[model samples]
Each structure stands twice: as structure tokens, then as C-alpha cells.
Target: MSGNVLSIADRQPEDVQRRAVAAVSLQRWREIEHARVVKKGGVPVQTDQGSDLPASLDAWYRSQPVKPGRISPRLTLTDDEKRAYGLPKSARLIALRGLGDEVDHWSVAVFPVMGGYVVGVKAPAGGGGVGVFWRLSHKASDYARRLSVEHGMLIRERYA
Candidate 1:
């Protein structure tokens, strides 16, 4: 998680900020990464969430080092959950921080709106902030729309 968070330090602010809008997306990425690296002795793979590890060697994979508590963990969509949501069997997920690229080093929430088949958007955090970015995919775009409708209202009521 720290590696992902710390990587934020080196990324283009605009990019990170764009992705951070939908905090859930970041959370999802965390979950995916965690699931992939739970063991050791597996083949190295790159997941949409980044760094894919086989189930066997997941426990032993060298985790990406990060500053303690530098950033919160990411949420993930399981294969079954994603399928239930009408998402593709395989879709990419990524999480990024909206620091340096904007004021107060705020973070963003993002994810595949639907099944990452077309487009996606960020759901912004507070004070009329910008949302995160999603790659073009139906799943991602649909999720973005749902986020705008569901979480968007909640966020607006709470933070607005």
C-alpha cells in the first residue's frame, strides 16, 4: 500500500488528482492488490490493480514499501462480485492520490463505473472538488454513473 501511496509522490499531479476523485476506486485497487499477494512462490503477473501474485506465493511476495499510514487501503471487487455486477471477467483497476497536484494533498475515489468497457469518472470528495478518472469501459463507466447517483448524493449531503 505504501508503495502505491509513495508512488503518488512521483506521479503527475493532474493524473493522480484525476484518478483520486472516486475514493472507492482506490479502495478497490487496494483490495485487489492484497488478494493477489497473500502468498509466495507464485508467478509474477500484472493486474489491473497492479502486481499480480499467484495464490500459492502470495504470502511471500515482497510488498511495495510505503511510509506507515501514509495512505489508507484500497477496496476491491472480487471476481464473483464483479461478475454479479455485470462486469467483464477481466478488468483493470488502479488507485492514486490527489496530492501535490492539488491543495491539501487530498485523495480521490475512482473505479470502473460498470465493467470498464467504455468510460469512468471520479466522484469528488469535498468542497466541490474534481472526481477521479476511469478508463473507457462499460463496467467502469456504469460504475461512475452509479457512483454519481448513489455515492454522489451521499457525499454532497455530507460534504456539501
Candidate 2:
């Protein structure tokens, strides 16, 4: 005769098993929803929430060395700028220094907003900030180059 042994889950009450299943389903749904929100450029409504760069770009930026006494500070977008870009309150703007010309030390600020990516040059001593919005990250690099050229800044080799 074959032995019949009840597993721990099988020993649980039917109601408990149903509840466990429902909980797992709900968690999976939440994961899908969160991904959908991020893909749409909206912040996910979860406890772990903040704006960040795409992984590859972030890694590249982090790997670069900053010059002494030239650490770039994280710039805060003004209320008007946030509204214009359709960015949420939690959005973060990053400025990577030493990426621009050696003379002026203009940093490159990049961030993702509700509809697209924003690439800009931090204002030098007496100029206003220059920003360009693009639909794709790759396309934004072109705008970055254009901005550098227009501003007479030479971007560090291989950086956009």
C-alpha cells in the first residue's frame, strides 16, 4: 500500500490556505503595478520611493572621479521647474561634476521626469541654467552635446 502523508500546507485549514493564496496573488499584482508606474515615468506608490538614474548610466557616472574641491552638489529643482517638467515631489536631480570643460567646471545635470528625461548644464558664474527635454535618454545625449558646444564647453571624453 502507498503511504499518504499530509504536508504542512495540506494540514492547514482550507480557509487559511485560501488566505495565503490570496496574499501571494495580491503581492504579485502590486509588483506588476509598481513596474507599470515606473515605466510610465511616475513614481511608484510604495514605501521605497525616490527618483534615480537608470542603472547603467548611474554606474558610469559613479565610476568617474571628481576633481579636488569640485564636488558637485545635488541640485534642487525649483517649484516652477518641477511643475514645468511634471516631476513629482520625490524626484531627485543629480549633477555630475568634472564632466564639462575644465575651465568653467560646469556640471551636467540629468534626471527623469513624468514624460521624459531632462539634460542641462548647471549655470556658470553669471548665466542662467540651460535645460533641454528629450523623449529618450539616448536622444538627450545629443542635446547635451549641443548644449556643451553652444556654451563653448568641452565635455570630458566619452561622457554625455
Candidate 3:
């Protein structure tokens, strides 16, 4: 692994969380929030609009096109987000919730078919479909686990 990645391995937990949040594209994170809302049947929750984000996430969102005619923008997840969401050993299927913006801001909610925190939700600035959300290539769960552990370690180190 690269030295930078190894450095991330030693970061504090909060730093890892911050980096994890920053690593994902703005649209992907929005989709996660949107999916969360759908799973809750359009329930209300605090939304993370692009305006409130740090430079890393906010800067990227500024360059992307807003989905069609939607007022709020959406963020999509990278393969890494899939890895995090896919970690629940007992999770059979992960369901993607569309979007819920009725009460406040827009967000997506995802829930396991069996039920649990395996689901992740993200909010978008403009109303739109999950933007550029991509699934990870097929691989053994062991491989996924390894990646998760490596990622977790890297995150811990980066924040340390």
C-alpha cells in the first residue's frame, strides 16, 4: 500500500470518520442520505447540504452538474462506500431508498433487506437521482473484509 494510505491507518477514530466522509463524492454522500429517507418511508431528519460541508466535499459538488431540473443536488458513493455498507455479515440484501425531501432537505436512505444499521443515508443539495453511484466488482467476502480492515486501520492512523 502507498505511504499515504499507511499513514491513514494510524489516525484517530474521529479523523477517520472525517476522512471517510470527505473521501466520498458529494453526490454519493447525498444519495446515501436520500436512500435513508426512503427506507424510513419519507421520514424527517437533519440534512447535510453542500453549503455546510468542508472544502473537500463542497469544492467537488460545485463542479458537478445538478441532476436535470432538480433544485437540490445529490452525491453518489464510490466503491469504498459500497464496501462499508456491505460489511454487515448477516445482511442478505441492501435496498436503496429513492429520496425524501418533503419535510426538510433531500436525502436517501438504505436499509438491509433483513433490517439493521447496514443501511447508509446521504443528503443532496439539489433533487436528483443517485449520481454516479457505482457498485464494487464481484469479489469474495473475505476480500471485502480485508479491504475494510485495511481501510479502518488507515483511517485510524490518519487521524492519530
What is the Cα-based lDDT of residue 123 in candidate 2?
Answer: 47
Stronger candidate by lDDT (1 vs 2): 2
TM-score of 1: 0.28
TM-score of model 2 relative to the true fold? 0.27
> Taking the tens digit of each residue's C-alpha lDDT, what string does model 3 give over 1-160?
5554546545668878777778777779778977887787776445433343323322334445668887544555343333344432322322223433322343333222221222222334432222122233222324333433533321110010
Model 2, 50-134: lDDT tens digits are 2443222233244455567865433555543454444445555545333244335555555455676667665455332434456
Cα lDDT listed for each candidate:
0.39, 0.55, 0.38
| Model 3 misplacement above 4 A | 1-54, 57-59, 64-103, 106-126, 129-132, 136-160
**Error at 69, model 3, angstroms:** 11
Regions more than 4 Å wrong, model 2? 47-160
Model 2 C-alpha lDDT versus the unseen true structure:
0.55
Against the hidden reference, what TM-scores do the models get?
0.28, 0.27, 0.19
The lDDT leader among the candidates is 2
For residue 33, model 3's alpha carbon misses the true position, in angstroms, by 35
Candidate 1's C-alpha lDDT? 0.39
